[model samples]
Target: MAHSPSRVFAAVSPSAGDVYRDENQSVFNRGRKQTHLSAQSNVRVIEVTGCAEVSSPPDRACVSISVKNSKENVNDVTNSVTRRLEYILQTARQHDVKEENITVTKHLQRDEDLFHMQAEVLVVFLDFEKMQQARTVLIEKLDKSVCVGDPYYSHSAESLSLLRRRVCLEAVDNARLKASEACCILGQALGRPLLVREEESREWSSSQQDTSGSPLTLHPRTDPTLISASSRMFVTFELRPKDNNRRKF
Candidate 1:
């Protein structure tokens, strides 16, 4: 089957100096016929910057739980830590947390005759409410040796990728709108896009503020723990004088 030719776009920066001269001379001034065109005929190039942000509720949480035990014998301390960790895992499983989402690490230290063993559990929970319940139960039922840390919230990889793509497209649309508006004001007609460049992209929690100190609230009605994906684009488009009658390639 035959496929349509893919369009190629080139990004050009005004500050690129000699590179611009070389390309323009090579593409537009190869022969006398092309160079003989009216000096008044020119392609107006407009560059604009656009930005967009998208937000979605966090789909995952990282809950860290620490279990520590001290005993005169190494075997005793290890056994105590293992029991506490097993109980925590059982409680988490009962709350619908999958075994794959849980990670366990063991650390053993010897201070003279005393043996200290510690187990750290990092649980990735899909449901925030269930995670909260499990955390409460662990604290209430477990001994003082078990310590639970605050939850760190985030979006799943697939969800974050979707949001990033959406914001990037939106940013491009924003650039087009700005370019069209500028052309209208200058009494010129907008032409095909010469370049579309994504300058910066970032994903952060909506509960936190960005570097500008502004709240990243893309979805105000959703939970404050939502994740926000932001993108900035630099776009350049060709412009033609409104009265010009040259055909577009």
Candidate 2:
């Protein structure tokens, strides 16, 4: 992380500004139009693989709570779980959870003289703070018959799409930055990128955030509160001699 990219010509290069650029999708700084270059043997080129990763706290979560009870009569068991189910639904409403994001399931069974009934309610939340509050309220209100599962966190569909695209752009910019530094060392001027392609892409999620106050252990173990995306890009750029400044092809 300490290896800073040497800004040889970042001001004039594609890697100068924010990595998440959409105003103009073109990677290059648009001071001049890019011209096609021939693939002749004389044309010198450099190839590099650029990798980038991005992560953000989850924007969505789901909380599930289940209640069950046994009674001498079927109606009594049903009423027991239904009352708690209605309370759960009401709690979800009070917390501003949308109707479409709430789900409820019920089950009833009888054996011998004992009647058993169970009901589960699932609520989806867009705000983490609100989710925590809701979970707390449910635990405080419900009795031993109720079970509340841990909140499941993840990014929304639109958020994941945007994150993937942004990481790809960052990878391209990284490649350009690395190649530019290499050109400076070899005493050559960097030219337009000739080819760019994504070599690989991966995404994964973990269970929970780190509690030890230390960095993540290794690959596949990311922050529990976040979803992440990474991309590796292969790029080929043109190289030019310092003397031929005006000859652009």
Candidate 3:
């Protein structure tokens, strides 16, 4: 074996021409290690807005009536107002108006030469037909001393509260529907809702406002004291690919 020492360091291994540099960025990613895609956009979202409006007619009316007269003596004036006061109450009860819904106030004073007696009746009516009937009875049976004022119409607290909540929910539903449609057009799937914001909310009567917050034009057949509520909402929704699986890039 010592006869050929030059062959000991011979060209048996690979030369520089035979060796090559690795083209991969990370050499550790080779061999048994598997490559993975990076997690991009953990949360992708789209924002949209929606609007809604609700309306209800006034459910109650307050009718006012006044009785006033002057006589030579305090007893005579008092008697006169008393007779009209009883008539007013009787008329309301005949029309099925509740006792608790009726109020009576009386006043008496001395003028220069006579006693002046005055009384007023306030009644709240839930049924418009009953209110009209009661009004007609008072106007027909009472003397000229009795004066009936116009009815005041309005909404109850409970009704207004329910209306506000309903309008807001409708607005939110509209927002979700709008977002879903947008995702569909964009070739994506709509995911869970991320957030909701009630941008604007307001309520007013037809006697006060319209769509632009101005005076509303009343229809002859519609209620003039109609109540209306409007709601505007903004919502954010997650957007995902129709196929919700990841792919190697």
Candidate 4:
């Protein structure tokens, strides 16, 4: 691929130092609280949805394992992952997992310091039916191998993305319920939303260190002992503004 100058130059600089302290202080204000009023109008402006959050354990896991070795010994790491990954694959098959459900997305190498090299193996799940059972089998295998370097585990991101959409819908409904109750407390009519916003997050693996040069492509072996499944989610919400102006009692 031809290198693009714009892409290579993409970076955020943090060199600013107190360029507008007085301006910022003048524009920002805090420490003010809304006071409850007793002679409020019969009409109530209630946010149709203030905020809501709910979480469910993830349904699958994304496990990526790597074996690292010295700069001149790339084959050593390759050989290690081969035996281990093969065992993991075999165990998945033994548990009745379909062959097509597992995929090796990437195998690559990046240069490290003077004497070290970094190798990566990317694995992903296409079927979740046998996830739990496969996880048990894989964890047992990993423990026995005592694979060097830390094991990086995560909730299946693709799976969590689907879950997030559903959870968002439920949260919106929950927020509406709260809005209705707020109106009742003020003894005023709830207003329609004038504006809305939403936000969400996930516990991402720390960003990988940058690397340069050609990548190695390794065929993943079927290994039961070096891989597993898991799940995760972050609470999030939608907020809407309301205008209380009319009520019928």
Candidate 4, residue 205: the lDDT equals 20
Clashing pairs in 2: 208-224
**How well does candidate 3 score on lDDT at residue 153?**
76
Clashes in model 3: which pairs? none
Which candidate number has the best TM-score? 3
Clashing pairs in 1: none
Worst 10 residues of 4 by lDDT: 3-12
Give the lDDT of residue 138 in candidate 3.
85
TM-score of 2: 0.65
What is the number of backbone collisions in each predicted candidate, taken in the order shown?
Answer: 0, 1, 0, 18
lDDT of 3 by residue, 1-249 (tens): 001000000001121111111222212211221111101333555566778888877778888899999999888899889988998898988888999999999888887999998999999889999898889888888779999887877677787888889888888777777666655655666777667788888765555344334443332222336777888887766656768823210
Better of 2 and 4 by TM-score: 2
Native-vs-model 2 lDDT? 0.68
lDDT of each: 0.68, 0.68, 0.67, 0.38
| TM-score of every candidate relative to the true structure | 0.55, 0.65, 0.68, 0.35
**Residue 34 CA displacement from its true place in model 4, Å:** 17
Q: Please write out the lDDT profile of model 1 over residues 1-249, one tens digit for every residue.
A: 111111212212222311111212323222222111122233445556777877777778888999998899998998899998999999899989988999999999999989999999999889888999999999899989999988877666698788888888888877777666656655666677766888888766635433333454443222337666778887766756668726431
Tens digits of per-residue lDDT, candidate 2, 1-249, equal 112222222222222221111122324344442222322433556566778877756777788899999999888888888888888888888888999999988888888889988888888889778888888988998899999888766567798799889888988888887876766766666777778889888775544454223332333221345556678887777777667655432
